[model samples]
Target chain A: MKNQLTVILAILLFFGTAGFSFAVKPGEQLSDPKLEQRARTISKGLRCVVCQNQSIDDSDAELAGDMRKLVRERILAGDSDQQVKDFMVERYGNFVLMKPPLAVNTLGLWLSPVLFILIGVGLFWHVSRRKPQTKKPIDTDETEHRLEEVLNKMKKN
Target chain B: MKIQPIKFLPVIILLGIGIAFAFGLRNDPSKLASTMINKPWPDFTLERVIADQPAFSREDLHGKISLVNVFGSWCAACVQEHPMLMRLANREGVIIYGIDWRDTAEAGSAWLEKYGNPYRKVGLDANSRLAIDLGVTGAPETFLVDKNAQIRFKVVGPIDEKIWTEQLKPMIQLLQNET
Candidate 1:
C-alpha cells in the first residue's frame, strides 16, 4: 500500500508540474525552436485586447490564441519582429503593444507622471520659500507681558 | 497671508482629477475604437461556408457600399444581432457580406439556415486568420465600407436598433452623399 501510494503521488506531481510548465497550447508552437522562441518573445509583449490586461502569451482567450497564431505565421513568412509588431499595430492600433511607443497619441501618457512630479516639486519649493516669510518670530516683549498678565489674573482668582 | 493662495492648490488639482474621472466614466468600455477606420479593407479570398456558393473577396466590396459583419456560430452575441442584420439587409437595400469567423463551415451554414441568411455572400474564416487581419477581437463586429473598399466606420459589439438609428444611419447618409 505504501509503495502504491508513493507511485501515485509521484505520477500526480509529474503531471502537475508538466501541466503548469506547458502553459502554451499545443499546435501553436512552430517546428523551428528558434522561431518558436522568437514568437513567444513577441507574443509576451502583445496585449490581449479582449482580456485588457494580460499578454497574448499568458491569455487563454480565443482572440489571443488567434493573435499568437498570427504572430507565428508572420514570422514564418519571413517578416522581421518589427514588421510583425507593425502589422499588428496597423490592424489593432498601438493599444495591442504592451509597451506603447512614444508617439503623438501616447506622448502625453508617458510624460504626465514626470510633469506632475515637476509641478509638485515646483509647488513645494514655492510654498516652502513663502513659509518662512509669513512665520516671523513673535515679539518677545508682547509674549512676556501677556504671561505676566495671565499670572496676575490667576493669583486674583 | 501669502500661504492662502497656496492652500487652494491641492483642491484645484483634485478638482481637475475629478473632472477627468467624470469624462472617463462617460465612455463605454465595451465599445472599442477601430483602427481600420479610413483604411483600405484587407484583401482576402475566403472559401464560402455554403459549398456551392461562390467565395468572397475584397473585390466584392467595390461598386457599392457594403457592411461586412464578422460572426461565428459559437458566439451568442451573433445570434442576438442576427435579426438586426436581417432588417438591415431587407430595408436598407445595401449589400451585407458575412465573415464566418472561427467556426466550422457546417455549423455556419446551419446557423444561417436557422436564423434566415441576411448576407449576400458568406466567407468562411475557419482559423480566424482573415478576421484577425480585419482587427476583429470578438464576434458580431460590423464594418461600413465605402465603394472604394475603404472601411469608413466599425461597430465592435451587437448592432441593436439604437446603434443603427443613432450612429450608423447618419454616417451612412454622409458617406452616400460623398461622391
Candidate 2:
C-alpha cells in the first residue's frame, strides 16, 4: 500500500509540474483572411526577436506569432510597408530588419565592406613597394675559421 | 629590422577603424532593438473601415496601447495564423487593430466570422497606400504601441504558439510593465 501510494504521488507530481510548465495560453484568432496572408509576407523580412538571424516568418518564437497577427491588423487598418517598418524602427531600431535602412544610424553597415576593400588596397601598396632583392654579405673570415674547425673536428672524429 | 611608426600610421588607423566598426555592428545584449525598455511609439495614420464606409483615418490610435496588423485575405499563411489571433484576443490588456489589405469586404467579414473577430477596430487598405508608408514589402506585419501611442514591438509573419511563448510574451511583459 505504501509503495502504491508513493508511485501515485510521484506520477501526480510529474503531471502537475508538466501541466503548469507548458500551459497553453489560447491566443487571439485572426478572422480576416487577407490580413493573414499579408502577415506571412511581412514576417519574411522582419527578424525574429528571440532567435538570431531568423526572420519572424521563419521563427517559432511566441512573439513572432503576435507580430504576424499584429502585422495583419495593421495592414487591415491600412498601414504601408514603410510605415510599419518605421513604427518598428521607432520602437526596436533598425536591428529588427534583416536589411537595415541606409540612414545615418546604419551608414557603417552599408559601407564596411567597401572600407575593407580600401584597407586591402593599402596593404597591397605596402607589400608591392618592397625591394625585389637584398644582398647578404659573406663573412669570409668566419667561414674560413669554421671550415678549419670543422676539418679539425672531422679529423678528430 | 626596426619598424617605422610613421610608416605604420595608415595601417594602424585602418585597423582601428575596422575594429571599431566591427564592434559597433555586434549585437549588444543591452541594446537589442525589440528589448528597448521605454520609448515613444512611432506616429502613423492608417486607413480604417468602420460601419460600412471607405477607409477612415486612424488618427485616434495615438493615446492607446494598440496593435496594428497588416494582412490580406488572399494570403494562405494568414489562414494558418487565424486561430492564434483568436487566442490572443482573449489575453489581457491587448487592443487589436486590423488592416484589410486589398480584399473584398464580404470575404474579409466572412473570414472574421470563421476564425473569430479578434480586433476591436478594423481598417481597409483597398489602395495599399498605408502599406507603402509602413514599408510593408509583403503581407502580415504587426506592431505594438504603448499607452502614450508609440510602437514598441514588431513581428512579421503568421503567428504560432511557440512564438507567442518566446518572443511575444516578453514584449507583452515589457508593455504590461510600461503602463
Candidate 3:
C-alpha cells in the first residue's frame, strides 16, 4: 500500500511540474501593433524549442513564451527580421527555426526523404533478383522406376 | 550458408544502436539548435527611463556594443537573472538595454527599483507588439548586438557565471576581433 501511494505521488508530481513548466496565458495588455507584426514575422519560422511540432508563436511552453517576449523587445528596441533570426540561431542552433537554412550540420535532415527512396529501391531490386528453387514434378510410377534404376545401378557398380 | 552467432551479435548491436538513436531524438521535446548568428540586428526605437525625464529612444544605441535584454516585472527568471545582468552591465563596451515586455510602466519601474537598474535604456513594450516583432514568446531572453548593430550572439535562458566564462565571453571576444 505504501509503495503504491508513493508511485501515485511521484506521477502527480511529474505531471504537476510539467504543467507548471510551460503555460502562456494571454498578456494582461494587448501587444503593440507594429512590434507585434515584427515579432510574428520572426516567430512564424522559429520552432518551439521546448514543444514538439510548435512554432514559438504557437507554443505555450515557457521557453516559447520567453522567446516570443524576447522577439517583441528586440523589435521595439530596433532589431530587423534577419537579426532576430540570427539571435535565436546563436543560442538554440538552426533547429530552432522551422525552416532550417542550408548548412552542413543539417544535411541529414534535408536529405532523408531522398535517401529513404533510394534505400527502398535497393531492397526491391534485391528481392526481385533472388534465385527461384523450382520443385521437380514427379509421378508415383516415375518415382518407382527411378528408384529401381538407382538400386540396379548401385548393385552393378 | 550457416548463420554465425557472432555475425548475429553484430547485427543485434547495430539494431539496438539504431533504435536507441531514433528513440533519443524523438524523446527530446525541445529541439534547441543555434540557427542564425552573424546576422544583422533588427532596428527599432524605444523610450529610455532616467531619474527626471521622458523616456529615450533608439538613438541612444548608436556607436556601441550593446546587449538587449527582454525581461518583465512579472517574469520570475528576470528576478533570478538580475545579478548576472548587473555584472555584465559593469563590463566595458557592454551596454545593457532592457525591454520591459508586456508590463505596465509603474510595474516596470518598480521591478527595476527592486532589482538593480543596470539597463542604460528601458523600453516599455506595454503592448506585446514589440515582443512579437522580435519573435519573443516570453521574457528574460538576451541578444548581443554589435557596434554595427548586427546581432552577434543570443542566450535564451538566464545568463550565469558559467555561461559568461564559456559561451558569452568567447562570443564577445570573437565579435571584438571581427570589428
Candidate 4:
C-alpha cells in the first residue's frame, strides 16, 4: 500500500512540474549539448511574435517554434549571441527582445525605480522633520511621591 | 472650511489613473509598429505559386509602386479579404504581388483558383522564410511599397473600403506624383 502511494505521489509530482519544462521538442534539440544550451539561452531572451508575453523558449506558438529553430540555425552558422539578437531586431524591431535595451526611448522605464526610491526617501525625511516630539521626560521624584501618597491612602482605606 | 488643494491629491491621482487606463484600453496590444517602414524590400527569390502565374522577386518591386500582400490558404481571414483584394485589383487598378506564406504550393494555387486570383505575381513562401524577413505576424498583412522599393506603410488587418479610399489610394497617388 505504501509503495503504491509513493508511486502515485511521484506521478503527481512529475505531472505538476511538467508545465515548467522547456518547450523545445526532442527533435529540435541540437546534437551538441553546448550548442543546444546556447540556443536555449538565446531563445529565453527573445519574445515570441505571436504570443507577446511569453519568450520563444516558453511559448508553444508555431512562430515561437520557428524562431527557436532559427536561433539554433544562427548559432550553428557561427553567429554570436548579440548577432542573433540583432538579426531578430532587424526584422521584428526591439519589441522582439524580452528585455528591451536601455535607449533614449526606454530611459524613463529604466530610471523609474531609482526615481521612486529617491522620492520615498525624500518624503521620509520631510515627514520626520515636520513631526514634533510629543513624548515628555518623566520626573522620578514626583512619581515616587505620588506612589507613596497612593500607598498611604490605600493603607487608611 | 477652506479647501486645501493637497487634500484633493487622492482624487487627482485617481483621475490620472482612470485617464491612463481609458487610453490603454482603447489601444490594441497585438498591433505593433512596422520596422520595415522607409526601408528597402528585403532580398528574396521565390518560385511561382501557380504554373500559369508569374514568379516574383525583391527586384521586381523596385520599378513600380505596388502592394505586397502576405496570405495563406489555411487562414480564414485571407478568404474574408479576398473580395476586397479583387475589387482593388479590378476597379482601382492597383498592382498587387502576393506572398503565399507558410503553405504548400498546391494548396496556395488551389486557393487562388477558387477565389479569383488578384495578384499580378504570386511567390510561394512554403517555409515562411520570406514572411519572417518581411516581419509578418499573421496572414493577410499588406504593405505599400513606393517606386523606389521602400516600404511606405503597412496594414495589419484586412483593408476595407474606408482604408482604401481614405489612406491607401491617397498614398498611392502621392507616391505616383513624387518626381
TM-score of each: 0.82, 0.49, 0.56, 0.84
Interface RMSD, per-candidate values to 1 decimal? 1.2, 9.6, 6.2, 0.9
Worst 10 residues of 2 chain A by lDDT: A20-29
* lDDT for residue A61 in candidate 2, whole number 0-100: 53
Tens digits of per-residue lDDT, candidate 1, A17-91, equal: 854552368889999999999999999899888887888998888888888998999999999999999999888
Ranking by lDDT: 4, 1, 3, 2
The DockQ ranking, best first, is 1, 4, 3, 2
What does DockQ come to for candidate 4?
0.52
lDDT of each candidate versus the true structure: 0.88, 0.66, 0.71, 0.89
lDDT of 3 by residue, B22-89 (tens): 88778534323333356565556555444454553556556667788989888999889998898788
Between 1 and 3, whose DockQ is larger?
1
The local distance difference test score of model 4 is 0.89
Better of 2 and 3 by TM-score: 3
- Cα-based lDDT at residue B157, candidate 4: 85
Which candidate leads in DockQ?
1
lDDT of 2 by residue, A45-115 (tens): 78765564777666655555556656666777799877766666654467778888799977877898998
lDDT of 1: 0.88
Model 3 segments more than 4 A misplaced: A1-52, A55-107, A132-157, B2-36, B47-56, B90-94, B132-138, B170-179
lDDT per residue (tens digit) for residues B53-141 in model 1? 98678888987888999999999999999989999999888689999998888999999999999999999998778888888888889
lDDT of 4 by residue, A92-145 (tens): 999999999999998978998897688568767766787687887998999999
Per-residue lDDT over B55-128 for candidate 4, one digit per residue giving the tens place of the 0 to 100 score: 88888797799999999899899898999999999998999999998788899999998999999889998766
Candidate 2 DockQ, CA atoms: 0.09
The C-alpha RMSD of each candidate to the native structure, in angstroms, is 5.4, 18.2, 10.9, 7.7
Off by over 4 Å in 4: A1-20, A130-157, B1-8
